[model samples]
Target: MRAVLLTMAALAALGLTGAVAVVALGLYNVSAVAGHLPGVSWVLHTTFRNSVWLRAPSEEEVPELDDAELIALGAGHYATACVPCHGAPGQEASATMQAMVPEPPQIEEAVAHWEANELFWIVENGIKMTGMPGWPAEGRDDEVWAVVAYLVSVQGEVAPELELQTGGSEPEEYCASCHGEVGGQVPRLDLLSAEYLEAQLQAYRSGKRPSGIMAQAVTSVPEERLSELATHFAETADEAGDAPVASAELVVKGEALAREGTRDVPTCLACHGEREDGRRKGPVLDGQRRGFLEVQLTLWRDGVYAYDPLMHAAARDLSNEDIEALAAYFARR
Candidate 1:
C-alpha cells in the first residue's frame, strides 16, 4: 500500500513539473495566428458550453421574448455593437473578426445552437478565453435581455418585422435608432428639456450613468454632437405612437403622491420641473412612458444611480407601490 502511494505521489509531482516547464520555457504557442494544440479546441468549446448551461437563468427567471418593442431595441443595439463581429443575416464577419484566435461566430448560425437562457448567460457574462466581452455596464441585465431577444428572434435571418436601421451616417439618426418609432419603455425624448437630455448623454459618456445600450450608442457620437442630438430630439416630436393608457384610479393615486410628499420624502413635483427648487434641475417627468419612469425610479430606489446622493437618498424610502403611482401620474400628463 505504501509503495503504491509513493508511486502516485511521484507521478503527480512529475505532472506538475511538466506543466511548469511548459510555461517557464514558453513552449506553448500564444499567437492568434497559431493553431490551438490537439484536443485544446474541444476542451475549450466543451467547457464554454457547460459553463453557460450551468449558469443560465431558469425558465421562471427569463422574461417573455415576444414583445415587438423588446426585439426592436435589441436589434438596434445589435446593429451598433454586434454586426461588425457577429454578422447579421446577409453580412459575413469581417476579415479582422475572422482573424481572432477562436473567431466570433455569426449570430445567425450560432444563436440557433443555444437556448434563450444560455444566450443570456453568454451575452451578460461573456466567455473566458474568446475575445467576446461581457456586457459593458454592470447590474444592467435588462440590457442583456434585450440582446438575447434579438438573437432568438433573428434565428439565422433578418425579418422585415424588425424595423431596425443597420447603419447611420449622422448622429441624430444613430440616436434615433434606439429612441425613435418603437416606444414602449424608452422615454419620450421630445418631452425632456434639452439641458436634461444633454446632461444624461454626458453622464452616459463619462460613465457616471451605466447602460450597456447607451454606452454603445454614445461611442460613435462625437462629444459636440451629443448636445446637437439632444436639442434636436427635444424639439422634435418622436414617432413613439400615441400616449400610453392608464386607469383613472392609478393616475389619481399617482398624482396625489406627486403633488403631496410623504413624511419620508419630498414631493415628486419638487424635482421634476414642477417647482423652482434646486432639485428642479432633474428631468421633466410629465408625458414620459410609465414603464420608463418606473424603471428609472426603481433604479434610483435600488441605489443604482448613486452618483447623485440627493436623488439616491430621496428615492431610497419609496415603496414599489409609491413608484408605480408616481410613474402612472407623470405618464398621464
Candidate 2:
C-alpha cells in the first residue's frame, strides 16, 4: 500500500511540474497563424463532432422542416447572416475569412456530414474556438430551424437568386432584398400601414428592437430615407394571396383566443383590432405570415423586445399552443 501511494504521489507531482513549466516558460503556442498540430487538430475536431451529435435534439423534437415557406425564410436570413462567413450557392467567402484558422466550410459540403438536428444545435449554440456564431436574434429558435430547413433543401442545389426591385434608392434596394421579394419569410410590408412600418424601422435602427439582421440593414440607410422606404412598401399592393392551410381545429382555437381574452390575458384585438379614434398601439397582425407572427410573439414572450413591456406581459402567460393558435388565426385574416 505504501509503495503504491508513493508512486501515485510522484505521478501527481510530475503532472503539476509539467503544467507549471508550460505556463511559466510559455511553452504552448498561442498564435492563430501558426495553426494546430495534426494530432491536436484531430482531437479538437473529433470532440466537436461528438459533442454536437450528443447534444442535438432528435428528429422528432424538431418541427416539420419540409415547408417551402420555412425554407424560403431561411434562405433570406442566410443571405444576410451567413453569406459573409460560409458563402452561398455560387459565391465564395471573402479572402480574409478563408484565411481564418479552421476556416468556415461551404454549407453544401458541411451540411452533408451533419443531421438536421445537429445543424440546428450548431446554429443555435455556436461552436467555440471556431468562428461560427450562434443566431444573433435572441430566443429565435424558429429562425435557427428555418436555416436548418434551408440547408436540408439546398444540399445538392444552388440557391435561387431573389429579385430586388430596381430603379429605387440604394436604401430601398436593400429593403427589397427581403421585404419586396415574393414568398419570403418576412411579413408582406405592402399590407402594413406606413406609420406602423416606419415605427418598426426606427425601432430597429435605434436598438429598441433586438434584431441583428435589421439593425445592420438600417445602418447604411440615411435617417431621412426611412420614411420614403416605408411609403414605397406601404403603397405597393400585396400580390401574395391567402395564408397556407393550417389545421381547421387549430385555426378555430386561435380565433377564439384572439377574440376573447382569458382571465389573465387581454384580447389580442384590443390593441390590434380597429379603434374608433384611428389609434393603434400595435402593428397590424392580420394577414401577416404565420411563421413571422410566431417568431415575433416568441421574442416578446422571452423579453427580447424591451421597448414594449405590455407586449411582454401579454405574451408571458401564453402556451405554445396559444401562440400557434394566435399566429394561425391572424395569418388567415
Candidate 3:
C-alpha cells in the first residue's frame, strides 16, 4: 500500500513539472489560426456553460425582459457595440470576426440555448479566453439588462421594429435612432436648450458622464460635430411631446410636488422651471418620458451619477413614489 502511494505521488509531481515546462517554454500554440486542439474546444465550451449556469442571477433578481423600451435600449447598444461581431438579423458575421478562434456565434440561435439569467451572467461578466467583454460600465446592471432584453427577443426569432428603424452610420442618425421620436423612452431633445444639449454631449464625449452605451456612441462622433448634433436634435423635435403613459391623478400629485417645496426637499421646478434668462444650462424636463425621468432621477439620487453635486443634493431624499409622481408630472407637462 505504501509503495502504491509513493508511485501515485511520483506521477503527480511528474504531471506538475510537465505543466510548468509547457507554460514556461510556450510550447502550446496560441495563434487564432491554429485554433484549439481536438477536445480543447469541448473543455472550454463546457467550462463556460457550467460557469454561467452556476453564477447566473436568480429568477427573482431578473427584471421583466418583455418591456419595449428595455428591448429598444438594448438594440441601440447592440447596434453600436455588438453588431460588429454578433451581426443582426439577415446580416452575416464579417470575415475578421469569423477569423477569430472559436469565432463569435450569431447570438440569435445561440441565445436559445441559455436562460435569461444565464444570458445576463454571460453579458455582465464576460467569458475567459474569449474576446467577449463584460458590460463596459460597472454597477449598471440596468444597462446590462437592456442587452439581455434584446437578446431574449432575438431568441424568439422576431426581430423587433426599432423606433421606426433609422438606418445610417452618421452621428445624427445614431442619436436619432433612440431620441428621434418624441414621447419615446429617451428624453425629449426639442424641449431642452441647445446650450444644455451641447454641454451634455460634451460631457458624454469627455467621459464626465459614465454611460457605457453613450460612451461608445459619442466616441465615434467627431469633436466639432457635438454642437451640430445637439442643435439638430434640439431644433428638430418636430414630433409633439405628450404623455404616452401617465394617470391624471399621478400627474396632479407630481404637479403639486413640483410647485410646492417640502420642508426637506425643494420643489422640482425651482431649478428646472423656466429661468429669467432665455438661455439656461438646466435640462428641461417638461416633456421627457416618465421612464427616462425615473431612471435619471434615480441615478442622480443614488449617487450613481456623482458628477453633479447639486442634483445629488436635490434628489437625495426622494422615495420611489416621489420619483414616479415627479416623472408622471413632467411627462404630462
Candidate 4:
C-alpha cells in the first residue's frame, strides 16, 4: 500500500510540474489575435451552456409579469442597457463591437435559445468571462424577472412611432427634476438613443444599475414614462451641450493616452479604430456618456463589475490617474 501511495504522489507531482512549466514558458497564447483552440472553445462553450442549465430553476413559477407590461418594461430596459452592446432594429452594434473576442451575441438570435429562467439567471447574476453585466445594484429580483420576460418576448421591428405603451404619465416632479429645462440638465437625456434611454430607466427600476436618486425619483413615476421618457429622449439628439467635453488639458492628455498608450498602457485606437472596424476585443467608446464611463470605471476599480475577466484585468492595472484621464478623454469625444 505504501508503494502504491508513493507512485500516486510521484505522478501528481509530475502533473503539477508540467502545469507550472506551461505557465512559466508562456505557452498559452493570451493574444486576442489568436483564435481559441477548437477543444478549448468547446470546453468553454459547453461549460457556459450547461452551467446556465444547471443553475436555472427547473420549475416554471416565475412571478406573474403581464405580457404587455413585460414587453413595455423590457423595451425600456433593453433600450437603455442591451442596445449599447447587443443593438436593436434600425441600430447596429458599433464597428468596434464586432471585434469583441467572443463578441456580444445579437440578442434576437441568441436570446430565444435560453429558457426564461436561464435568461433571468444570466441577467440577474451575469455570465462570467463574457461581457454580459449582471444587474447593476443587486437585490431587485422582481425587476430582473421583468427584464427576462421582455427579452423572451421581444422580437422583430420596433415601430418608429409607437406611443409610450404603458398606462400612466411620469410624475411631474421626476420629469422636472431631471428634464424641467431649468434643471441642471445633468442627464443629457436629449442626446440619448431611444433604446439606450429605455434600458437605463429599466435598470434603475430593476436595481440593475446603481442610482439611489434615480430609484427614488423614478419609482413613483408611472410605468408609461419608462417608454415615454425613452422615446422622447430617443427622438431628441444632443438638444443642448449634452455631449461630453473634457477640458482642453485633460483632452490632450487623454487623447494621447487613448490614441497612443504610454509605456505601460495600450493604445485605444489600435484596437478600436478604423483599422479593425473598432471591432477588436475592446468595446466601442464612441458616443457613450461620460457619467456612464465614470460609473463603470468606479465599478472596475472597486471590483464590483464582474461581467468579464478582461475588464477586471484591465481595471486591476489602471491607476486613479488613468481612470480620470480616460474618463475625461472619452467624455470629450
Candidate 5:
C-alpha cells in the first residue's frame, strides 16, 4: 500500500514538471495578438491585484484635507510633468502615447491600486514591464509627490488658471513672443524667482524634462536668456492658490504637522523655511493650496515626484501624517 502511494505521488510530480517545462519552453503562444486565455487572464489580473495590495504599505495616518495652495502648486507641476503622458480632465494622452505597448493607463482607473508609497516608488523607480519611465531626476522624490498632489486636483472641477499656458505663434517663435518680449502677454523679467526658473530651464537643457515643442523653443535661446527667462517667470509673483479652497481645520492641522513632524519624521521647516540658514534646496511652500499639497505629499511618500535630488530626499522622508499636515497648511495660504 505504501509503495503504491509513493508511485502515485511520483507520477503526479512528473506530470506537473513536464507541464511547467512545456510552458517555459515556449510551447504556448505568448503574443498580444493571441491574447491571454480566459483562465490565464484571470490569473494574471488577480495576481497583479493581489501583488499590488500585498506590496503596498499601510499607515494609520490619514492625509489632511485642507491644502488649497499646495494643490495649486501641484497643478503647475502636473501641467508640466504628467499631462503629456496621462492627459488632464478634458485632455487626452498625446498621439505617441496611444501607440505605446500596454499603453499608459488612465489615471482615473490606475491610481486606485497604489498606496502613496507604492506610487512614489513606481514614479522614482518606474515599472519594469511597462511604458512608465522613472522621473528624469531619478532621486527627486519631492517633485514626484508634488505632481501626485496635482494629479488628485486634476480629478475635480479644476480652475481655468490650471489651464496650460500657451502662446499663439509659429513653433520656434511661439515661446519667444511671451518669453522675451517686454510687457509680453506673459510676465516679464524679474517676475520669477531665480531658483524656480532655473530648475525648469535645467530640466529642459538636460533632457530631464520632455517637451518636443518646448525643447525646440529653448535650444535657440542663449544660456543667459534661459536664465533670464526663468527669472522672468519666477519673479511674476503669482499667488499660488487658484484651485478650490479646503477646510480651515485641515489647514491648521496640516500646519501643525509641517511645523512639527512626528517621531519618525522631521518637520518641514526644520529644513524648509524656519531654518536660519535654510537647509532645504527645493522650492519654498508658503501660500500653496490643500488639494495640491495633499497630492504632492502622497506622491513623495509614494516616491514618484522626480525632479531634483534634494526634492527626492525631502519627499522620501515624509510620513503620511507629515504629508497631510504640510499640504493642508500650505493650502490655507
Candidate 6:
C-alpha cells in the first residue's frame, strides 16, 4: 500500500512540475500565428463534433424548415451576419476572414455533416475557440431556426443575393422581397402602429429582440429614415383579398378569447382594443397575419421580449390552441 501511495504521489508531483515549468518558462506557444499542431487540431475538432452531437436538441424540437418564407427570413439574416465570415453561394469570404486560424467553413459543405438540431445548437450557442458568435438575441430561438431553415434549403444550391437595398430611403422596395409587394405571407405592415413598428426596429438594432433578419434590415436603414419607413408602412392600406381565410369555428373561438379572455389570461382587448382615453399599451392586433400573431404570442410567452412584461404575463398561460384562436380572430379584422 505504501509503495502504491508513493508511486501516485510521484506521478502527481511530476504532472504539477511540468505544468509549472510550462507556465514559468513560457514553454507554450500562445501566438495565433503559430496555429494548433496537427494532434491538437484533431482533438479540438473531435471534441467540437461530439459536444455538438450530444448537446443538440432532438429532431422533434425543431420547427418545420421547408417553408419558403422561413427560409427567406433566414437568408436575409445570413446575408448580413454570416456572409462576412462564411461566404454564401457565389460569394467568397474576405481575405482577412479567410486568414482566420481554423477558418470558418463554407456553410454549404459544413451543413451536410450536421442535422437540423445540431445546426440550431451551433447557431444559438456558438462553438468556443472558434470565431463563431451565438445568436445575439438570447432567447430568440425562432430566429436561429430561421437561419437553420435557410441553411438546410440552400445547402447544395447557389445562394441567391439577399442584400438589402441601400442608396434610397424608400422601405417599400427593400421590404417587398420578403413581406411581398402587397403583404402576402408576412404580416400586413400597414395596419401596424408607427410607434410599434419603430419600437420593433429599434429592438432589433439594439439586440433587445433577437432577429437576424430584422437586425440586418434595421441596420440598412439610416437612423434618420427609421420613422419615415415606419410611417410609410403604417399608413398604407392592406390590399384587397390579402386576409387569410380561417375556419368559422376557429374565428369564433378567437373572437371570444380576444374579447372575453380566459380566467387566467387577460382580455386581448384590454390592451389592444380601443380605449376611451385613446391610450394604448399594446400594438393593434387586428388585421395582422395569423402566422405573425401566433409567432409573436409564442415568443412573448417564452419570455423573449423583456421590454414588455405584460405581454409575457398575458401569454404565459396561453396554449397552442389559444394562440391559434387569437391569431385567427385578429387576422379576420
Query: Which candidate leads in TM-score?
Result: 1
For model 3, where is the 10-residue window of minimal lDDT?
Answer: 159-168
lDDT of 6: 0.77
Candidate RMSDs in Å, in order, are: 2.8, 3.9, 3.2, 19.4, 9.7, 3.5
TM-score of each: 0.89, 0.80, 0.86, 0.47, 0.46, 0.84
Kindly report which residue stretches of model 4 are placed more than 4 angstroms away from their true locations once superposed.
Answer: 1-7, 89-93, 155-333
- For model 1, how does the per-residue alpha-carbon lDDT over 119-171 read when each residue is reduced to its tens digit? 99899987777878899988787778878887888773553343335445778
lDDT of 5 by residue, 1-333 (tens): 999999999999999998998888977775655655768656755775666556544533224322543344445545545666676665666777676655676665566555655565555556555656666554444445555554555444453244453544332233433343312012233433587667766776776654332343466466666666665555554432244455777677766666765565555776556355644544566655443355556655565545555445657766776676666576454
Give the distance in Å from residue 330's predicted Cα in candidate 1 to where it truly belongs.
0.6
By lDDT, highest first, what's the ranking? 1, 3, 2, 6, 4, 5
- Of candidates 5 and 1, the better by TM-score: 1
lDDT of 5 at 176: 36
Give the deviation of candidate 4 from the true structure as CA RMSD.
19.4
Off by over 4 Å in 2: 1-26, 90-97, 156-158, 162-169, 182-184, 193-195, 205-208, 212-228, 238-242, 245-255, 262-265, 301-307, 317-325
Q: Write the per-residue lDDT of candidate 6 for residues 1-333, one digit (tens) a residue.
A: 999999999999999999999999999997877899769999999999999999999999988787666777678677667877787765566787677888888766668788889999999999898989877667777778888888888774744556644566366667655554323235777777898888877887888887666776778767778888788878876562344588999999988877876666678898898789987667877777877788888888887766777678888878999999999888886
Give the TM-score (vs. native) of candidate 3. 0.86
For each candidate in the order shown, give its overall lDDT on alpha carbons. Answer: 0.80, 0.78, 0.79, 0.61, 0.54, 0.77
TM-score of 5: 0.46
Per-residue alpha-carbon lDDT of candidate 3 for residues 7-27, written as tens digits (9 for 90 to 100): 999999999999998899998
Scanning candidate 5 in windows of ten residues, the lowest lDDT window is 180-189
Model 2 residue pairs with clashes: none
lDDT of 4 by residue, 14-85 (tens): 999989988999887877668687798789889998998898876566755444433454455565456667
Model 3 scores what on Cα lDDT?
A: 0.79
Candidate ranking under TM-score, highest first, comes to 1, 3, 6, 2, 4, 5
